[model samples]
Target chain A: MVLASGSMALATRTERTPSLIGSVWRSTVGKKAVMAVTGVIMLAYLVAHMLGNLKVFFGAGEFNHYGAWIRTIGEPFLHHKWFLWIARVVLGSAVVLHGVAAFQLSRRDLAARPAKYAHARRRASYATRTMRWGGVILALFIVWHILDLTTLTVNPNAEEGRPYENLVASFDRPPVTALYIVAMLALGLHIRHGFWSAAQTLGANSPRRDRLFKVLANALALLLTCGFIAVPVGVMTGVVS
Target chain B: MNLTLRIWRQRTADAAGAMTSYEVSGISEDMSFLEMLDHLNEELILAGDEPVAFDHDCREGICGACGMVINGQAHGPERTTTCQLHMRHFADGDTVDVEPWRAAAFPVVKDLVVDRSAFDRVIGSGGYVSVPTGSAPEAHATPVPKPVADLAFEHAECIGCGACVAACPNGSAMLFTSAKVVHLNALPQGAPERESRVLGMVGAMDAEGFGGCTNTGECATACPKGIPLQSIATMNREFLRASLRGGRGA
Candidate 1:
């Protein structure tokens, strides 16, 4: 019997099929964790971007210099615009991951409730309900925003180095300004629910901390919305040009 | 009092269902929601018609057996089990919509009866402790903190009624799953399998085809047991801890 057991022990060993990371990404809870992490990364970037955008109110020279200074960040260790490119890569990856997880989760959610209640009633808050549509709007806005500002592709008065003039040119038209306003509002609504949701997903929210997280979410959403909209409103009123 | 009921009527599991209207008269305001339904069923049975089929075990709210979406709300508007919801909340001539719990994991069996064995599977995964079988130990032999016991008891109130699934827009079972996970995980008795318990139950939940949570708060709001939404957060914390510690071998 000992000899037989020893012989059986020599058989090929098997490793776990799905690795820890593989299972984590595949599981719904883990996918939500991914969304939460990536959402925080993008949110941090937006705060910086919004602050940088506010530099335009100080006049063209300061704003343009601020834009140029960002390219030269990490001066000696990193080459010119390397920091910008790196940030773009990180932010782009965050966006893709956030979007893919959201898409898959949304599909699963819809499929889970195939039969709608006959006595249809409105469910969830307005911000919660608008999350999907707002995410799509934000995704589209990112593309258009890159084209108009970063790449100088769609800006009517495109120039290589003058971000301040470019900003004024993009917001000059009423339709463009209106679109910006609508997108900013959508951004606000998205952040309103998203920040609190991220806290919950990350296990940071408790019954005691719930109120504080809600207040922070509301404050962040309101601040970003008003700050971004102020730019186009300024352009419309001839304050930045 | 007279009332109109637009109850979902399906012959079998595969049969197409619809809202079949029936007028029920002489319903006393003191009658529970299930009692009113019983009144309707009695009339139908007397008329030589197929009586409405529903699930009800204890007729008491504690059993967690009776459940139906009453007017688009799970277990009705009063935030209690269907068996406990009194008819006084409704007025004469009111129309009520009764439907079974809706979720991919919970399929309709008959009229207002859903197959909730998915929850059983989830529970079977890891919702228990492996204690040594013998004569029971002395009462205070295993010391437990008062707060910890209270927390465990709080989550232990879950009746497995699936109201959370019905109320959730996404039909997510996170609330239900979290309640079980938290209830067991918080206790010292559940310590031996803490990591494995969370990993196993969460895996089973996903396998059951229940939706992922979106933190909509609807599930907690509609919960007849009043299980807090924070339970899911605690489960999330547990899951992350288990995953980080590599809950593979156990």
Candidate 2:
């Protein structure tokens, strides 16, 4: 076995093929690229999800049909609910990859600077500083959100297969609404930093484009926050009732 | 002016380091920050004690060799190199905390000296332009535009100090790597190897165990050379283009 291993090593010396994928995943830049790509995927889902949520203002029939339509997408060609399940699978993987990459990167960062500065001064903004905690809050909120809406397990007035009714019922309670509003705020902060950061990681930023990107990031954060929170506010104000 | 300094004392690279306090009186406000340290060191030597060992050369701030975290800042309270920081910034009897650059890639050698040779390695990876030795070419042969020249010069101002890594909460070396990438990539002569350069430098940067950039912008703020934050974005753009072109197996 030792002789064979030695021969293999000698044969490959100075002429081994570099595994590009392995190198990319192993480097910090590569991990950042993964995070940026996954972030964009999640952002697309958020926008589409926000647009779907706005259908609540169009009344129960429209909102319910929209919800049902998602599951029935690709019906004749594919199995019923297959499209929705596929989306869930894709989004679930993205979330897992994003979370794992973030966790590992953060751990590497902590290890890089094992000693803390005695009188360390912060040079970053509030959003940049709170990114870790904000990510944690968002992660926790995702679990609660899936339970309350998708699975209908923790929702007090969950109606099976009735997304419109379930959303209204969940938001009808003040505490749940408050929790959701808080989560939305955290999401806003996350998006505010994440959007601009992803653009940078993906190499889309320049001196001329920097201001535009910042404005777009802020606008997106505001739009998403208002869009998501509007559903709960609509419930509280009886606008969607 | 009298001052109290709490400087990090490490006997060797493998030895555990800690903050050690020292008192020095009659320090002049006209003295540079390093000169104040010199006074302290002289006192330590006079008393037959081990003097604090720190890195510095070309006290003019252009060398990029001198760096220390003073009162939690990469170079000092001012956005200048430690050697350039004057004693006037501090009041009499002020307590200053001095420490070496604290990144895993820049381990403390002793006192305020860290082994910044990792930076040299990252540079050796691909930070240089490869032109065969020959007679000087015509000055305007390349014909770089004014804006491009200015931008390249801006990035070229980076002194290779490890302050960016030290000031960063994550100890990221993006600013340094990006500075080199932008400096060389902007030149017309650099176009040939631009893709490979960025790939090799970024690969080496990550291999050195430096943290990833989260866009905190601290490195730019802490950079003594005033290397702008946009250099990092420019490097990112170059890296992306190279990766898309299959230059580094993206």
The DockQ values of the predictions, listed in order, are 0.70, 0.56
In candidate 1, stretches whose alpha carbon ends up further than 4 angstroms from where it belongs are A1-17, B248-250
CA error at residue A54 for candidate 1, angstroms: 0.7
What is model 1's DockQ versus the real complex?
A: 0.70
What's chain A's TM-score in each predicted model?
Answer: 0.94, 0.91
- Report the Cα lDDT for residue A236, model 1: 88
Tens-place lDDT per residue, model 2, B122-220, is 999889988988999989777999998998899889999889999999899999999999998999888887888888899888888888898999899
Write model 2 residue lDDT over A1-241, tens digit each, in one string: 9999999999986433245676567778778889899989999999999998999999999998998889889989989999999999999999998999899999998888788887767568887887889989989999999999999999877887678889888988899999999999989998899999988888888878889989999999999999999999999999977
lDDT of 1 by residue, B161-201 (tens): 99999988888999999998999888888988898888889
What is the Å distance of residue A85 in model 2 from its true position? 3.0
lDDT of each: 0.91, 0.88
Q: List the residue pairs that clash in candidate 2.
A: none
Measured on C-alpha atoms, candidate 2 has an lDDT of 0.88
